[model samples]
Target chain A: MATNSLPKADLTSSGRPVFLQNEIECSILSSVDLECDDIPNFPLLKSGLLVLTTHRLLWLPDNSSSSSSSSAAAVALPLSFLTHIFSTKKSVKTLFHSPRVRFQASLDSSKSVVMTVVMRGKGDTDAFLAKFWENWRARAWENDVQTQTQAGVGSSSVSGSGPGSGSGGFYTREGAVRMVGVSGILRKEQEMWESTDKSLQEAFQDLNALMSKAKEMVILAEKMRQKLLSGSNSKSSATNDDEVGSKEEMQDWLLSVGIVSPVTKESAGALYHQQLSRQLADYVRIPLERAGGMINLIDVYCLFNRARGTELISPDDLLRACSLWEKFDVPVMLRKFDSGVMVIQNKSHSDEEVFARIKALVTNPDTLRTGISASDAAMTLGIAPGMAKEHLLTAESKGLLCRDISPDGFRFYINLFPEINTDDVYLVKDYGIYNTWVRVASASRLE
Target chain B: MRRRPGIGGLQTAAAARDQYRLVGENVAKIRTDMMKEQLATFRTQLEEFARKHKNDIRKNPAFRSQFHEMCAKVGVDPLASNKGFWAELLGIGDFYYELGVQIVEICLATRPHNGGLINLQELCILLRQRKSDREAVSEDDCLRAISKLKVLGSGFEVISVGKKKLVRSVPTELNKDHNEILELAQAQGFVTVEEVERRFSWTSGRAIDALDTLLDEGLAMIDDGHRDGKRRYWFPCVSSNSTPVADT
Candidate 1:
């Protein structure tokens, strides 16, 4: 109840604090406490993660270390409310005691109180204080407000910015001369093309320039996607199949176009791999869902890099990031096949689900005779061919399937090795895939 | 409710499709332009990074592999031409190309016995023995070269058989019957026709036909001197404990 005095911070699925728009994390200090001696009912937040970001000071419970108090939620204090920071004094008494940074913040319009942050972990106190001061002075939240107003002014019609935009038609205005029908669409397309040409020209000016422009390009992509989305929904009954299909494709490309603040070595320093691993865990959830709870590491590398846009990490860095997941309590894991192929999969991913699908595939009458290849499983599983092959090989090892290699190429069939009665190869089981395969093969032969 | 089922409907449909196509073209153009820009910038940055850290990239095998991967994404083929800067700076191109040629030669030499199917571990040993330098060739290196050899056609491939990688250098086909027999022969180094028939629920004739095909292909051999008077067909290619590659 005392903790409710401070505003709560939202957490990602992987336990990372959900940052405000353009709020970049500056530094992280573990095992820190926020104490307010001025307020009687103030709860002394103890031994948690304190993150310094451009807009706020985030306190997240150390999920890995605190098993007993796992319910301890994260909280955020905006830098805008800070009135002053009490600098450390160089005294023998202070030197003996734990390093603490005190600051004055207003809880509401009437009450203002002094708060203390005691650092229990091994981190640079001076650097954290410097970043705190810098961030408080920088006031990055002001920029968000400016961009919000600008975006509002730019697209008065496209109010909803996310994937779930409302199904409002393009001609939704009342007083302004509205363009209707085909000519209106053509004019709108022409206007967008001119702006796109300008942005493209500006973006390609130089690499440094491109990096700065990446954010704008992502916004532009999102806006265009929203336009297409609403355009599709409003005209769903009037559009042709190819038009609807292509619009959906464009939406997909735009959806995966940004990761606003990707973790870089320059940003996270010694915690680079750790932070990257957490971010990757959150990033791969959507792609993993699309890929049936598993994806090849190589495919993830391409997708992650594409989303990151400019700050490309090496494969070694990616491997290290993925390997670090074992130390963190993330829902995703790094797996290595017996053949040395690596993949990122959800911890909840069950081989039995994949085996069941492969079982269905191989038992099909046509596939029962000719068998299925990695490509066949890839199409059905909605995963990469190499990943599908790994799944197939896993199923083979599990005795769910068997391999067939010949001029027709390497393929898999339902494993009849177990179902076979070695004592009498002539005897057919009344049940099992072997019997089904035999019946299908015999029927095909008869045909 | 907005359905039009006449001439005017067709016109509107055509106009809507045209508008969609126009918008789609613009979006595609923007996406491609953005991609091209990113790729170009990444290429320059990669070249600079490669130049500055060429020593680290060469000395560290993991770093070298990562560098190769980064180069691959930016449309740079460091191994394309040996006369270029990548060759002079890295020399990884010649290293893999030479290894590739040696792999081909070894595959050709061992074809008669292995039936063009050899264990990847065995192939790496042969490669190391054939070379005199202190430079070590790993299975990863061989795999990379083999991937590049894909340009040669469908004759070369790496197949996984019970946790073992077998490099197939010939275009021979092994159907379901042949694969099952090979798998059954994996245990105890060899299998009898009776075991194969009993295990696969196949008739004696079916088992013998598969075993005979494997024998004729030189992938297996018949050992008739058994105490029970039962013939054993041993598959050298599929056997894990056997080191027949040494004698071959």
Candidate 2:
């Protein structure tokens, strides 16, 4: 709690704290205060949000509840600093008082001090304390530190001892199970072979075992990704294209399962949807970017559930979470089209940008002849066909495009609705997209 | 390029002159016979094409529409007769006639509830309920069949009352104002003078004038029981009676 002792909390635009690499949020407690008994210049983190993560204990001023807390900077106390956690005391005095958690942490210059976390709100205080202890013992940060120092060669042997570590990487778990400290180079080769053998044997295991194994599976996947990344960076030409392709597929599958610390109903309780919405806003930035600033709600539902792995939320829950985004000042919105199809889009997503793309697509010489189908736009826009259809329809409604319903399929053309002189249907403009369309459409006739 | 004869009569006389001489008449007859033979061959080819893509024509609305376009180009109106060559080949003419007859049955049955003004989508739903799932019809198909019913002198026609398509079975000539009033009443089952004025961007006089006509024709009911004294025009024809009174 000493002044300038703890690292500053990096926050997302929506005021949620930015997690460290491979870090995940575990629990949240509101209206919490962090205080140190001995330190004089300790920052007064009074009645703020307390977030327990795999790597750090983050405390932020609850800007969502109290506007006054906006000026108070967010702070993080890495779990690495903690020396011991005190047990809860039971008494009549404790019942009348707010829940309190005490822990000793060595701050800057190894000066260990006693810090008390006072939970003033009616959050699940006991659950927060229990997660605090569990996270401290799990020591995910220590594993990360070990992985870096070892260059991940002996990663499979030691990190596999952690709870739920059996779902280790396909490379590491199969390769290094029986190997000790031989030559570091020889050990990796041995580990790879062992992993291959083990994977086949473990293929028929019960799902319950695999359920427990999933957590470590994520860690092992991360480790393998790190190794592959470093391998690519150092020896790009040496790695075979086949190897990189398989690695990429493995990474993608593993990355989908990367949201290790999903905000569960049991964890957030009454504030489940609100917290989920905030988390979702943070989660969608990368996906939104990938989808060109917007994605259908159905696609989002699948991606979110896939990312959460075993912690799958219901569609109703996902919808409620999306609906709660409106109440909060988030950077994403849930938009419902005229057709009742819903999508999650970036707040900055503009129809002009999409229309410009559609205009470009429809006005192309090839597209001018045949017109652009929804699937054609979907492929070009890197979006789902249904979503592309919505965009196309929106563009159509805006008169930026017009539809041609025919035997081939439903398609869109750059809107000639305005440029079209209905008084003379046969009159050609002699210029513009409409003129181009006419020329292209009649090219076959001329031939 | 000018001909010496008066253009219309000259062309007619030239046409007759060819038939006057025996050789000229015989040559003309052969040409006419050849054109007829080509038309017959074209008809047979079209029938084969229809037979080959029968399921496509039946299942895909867009495909069926394309086939219809082709038929139109060849002066072949498949829906013209029930027992014609096209009907024998595809039975599409029979299908539409059956659909039109069923639509007539539905319109009369539901006429009391909607005052002979039924929503097109609702009418199609009722039609589908009466028929099997194999015969899935679209709005365009319904429109086509309904147009054929006009020959019966029954005012079975589709009208756009707002975004909803309303099938008006009665021969009540609905002007734009009356149509607007009916459409306005569609949402809430009733509309006051103020509501109509706000909706159609009309003045109070225009709104009252339209509402008065509807009330006089008995197409709409007058509800002035409220304490506010605002005259509410409720079009029983378009209003399906689901909306509550307080919505106005």
Candidate 3:
């Protein structure tokens, strides 16, 4: 066995491939073998899940595969190497043979080979071939590569007055006559309404129409992001504070409109779940970072589906996907609390930090007086109430806090248990939290 | 020139040592006697304090309980014989004795209806009616009085089923199964045969049998008024608004 020098795809800690900018997964096929007839030392790449993206084609060893005999290492083939794709054969001879799609690709500029994509798995071979051509021609990554140079032009025109230009067309901001403050805002609002009105009209024309518009929608989102980025950079001094603020707000809204070529059941076939899991592992990194490194599984589901737009996954699928994270070396992980509450947290997220925060929240004078309910902690921590409860319970188990179950409902207070002198219940030490509590409690009793 | 330091000289020194030993013994005896004298004085002082606060000890439950704690630390049982200097001073012994007598009367009165098992709250209600504004009886006072009445027999005791205190006025001993049924009934103040079946994973027959025994013992009441037609075995012994019953 010779050392196979195929391009190694970098996998996320959770086992998802690190995607290039603007690259999106188009389709996936299981039990695939990427073989080049002319290249004999191409490594015995047998029966792995093949994923086609706008930028690259990736192959990962199937979980049930006996690839231990071969180099089961995942490999990526840049789509740029794909010189030509042969149309599928629909003859009776093709029916007798395994379904295959052939294309010309090169590992480098000098060596080219006819690559055969053997799809032993069951799926619409023609549909996969169609998407293969569609993404190849779309060339989404070529646009991302030119981003730095196009940035200046991208920005100036998107500032409400450029000549209806930038990013080759779809979802480009056409422009309004340059104005200041209120009028500019009104014009921005008018432009937003017209875009919505136009998209809605096109979306409802028919299902096929909506499906065709999907790519345009993704491109529009990308274009808006570019415009916003440029609007802030090149025209920061020119634009008023309010204008910049609106642009920033728009940037946030458009930021998550990705997963452009979401892996669908129809596209991914039997590999739907495996591909979806990897995609989810990729999608959750940003939101998980913002949510203090921990978020309820339900929140992740809602956010992931919202960002995905039309590619909504079931709760069962989300759970299975999250569970599969254990097998991969992804940066984020799924954590199930003792209370059966499931959450996603960054692998580097320390419970000690959360406990420290909870300790601070509980010991504050107002909190000491009234204590904190789960909802109150949620408001302070900026998380969902249910997730906050799980945190509170964790803190309680760690002995950082104690629960007070009363008619008012369950609340948590800083654990003053250690400070309390059980030998003499009436005695309050002159220093420490106990005396402070005693003073406040006694004073409050008079009121 | 002054002292022989060895053997027979040491024997003469032993006589002096004996005399010093005698003196130390005498001193120890006197110290012990002094301690006894101080203890006697302390007891007298405690009595005087009790006399000073006799009205407070009698009328105020908080003050009375505090006084009781002080007495307990000194190994004083004021109600031990009910006839003592301590009893005369605070009159706490008589208060408990009176409470006990009233409790006995109420338990006997409710025995026919509740099958010698009654809720503590209902017993308190009856006692208040019998002796209105007398000493302002509390559940704690009732519990203490009943604890004293336990001297009559093992049957006069308080048993808790869930949060409800039941005073069993009969001599029947409840086993674990009966106690568990009562404990389960505490949540909604009542349990049904179906609920018992579901909660304890008991067969319908087993649930009915246990509930029926409780019903027969007057520890529980039955309501057939439910729309679902399930017999709700209401254990007044474990119900929220019922009196604590005592066993015989």
Q: Encode model 2's per-residue lDDT on A1-447: one tens digit a residue.
A: 346576799988767788786576777788889888767787778988888887899988877674555666898999989999999899999999898999998886657889999988889877788788888888878767654644455455434422112332335433344433323334444354455335423521533332344333334334434444433454233425454544355335435434545676655666677778887888888878875676656445545654553344655677888888877798888876554456677877767777877888777777666566654565566553445667888888787877777543466777776777889988887898778877887895788
Candidate 3, after superposition: displacement of residue B160 in Å? 33
- Evaluate residue A106 in candidate 1 and report its C-alpha lDDT on the 0 to 100 scale: 89
Question: DockQ scores for all the models shown?
Answer: 0.03, 0.01, 0.00
Candidate 1 clash pair list = A405-B174, A406-B173, A406-B174, A407-B173, A422-B198, A422-B199, A425-B201
Please say which candidate is ahead in lDDT: 2 or 3. 2
Clash-forming residue pairs, model 2: A167-A217, A174-A194, A174-A195, A175-A191, A175-A192, A175-A195, A176-A191
Model 1, CA-based lDDT: 0.63
How does candidate 3 fare on TM-score? 0.42
Q: Which digits, one per residue and each the tens of the lDDT, describe model 1 over residues A387-440?
A: 566688888888888787764346787888787778998899888778888899
Of the two candidates 1 and 3, the one with more favorable lDDT, higher being better, is: 1
Question: lDDT of candidate 2 vs native?
Answer: 0.60
Please provide TM-scores, in order, for all candidate models, with all chains considered together: 0.49, 0.44, 0.42
Which run of 10 residues does model 1 chain B get worst, by summed lDDT? B239-248
i-RMSD of all predictions: 15.6, 30.8, 39.9
Question: Which candidate number has the best TM-score?
Answer: 1
Model 3 ranges with Cα > 4 A deviation: A1-6, A63-70, A87-97, A108-111, A137-151, A158-258, A326-333, A336-340, A347-447, B1-248
Off by over 4 Å in 2: A66-68, A149-151, A154-257, A351-447, B1-248
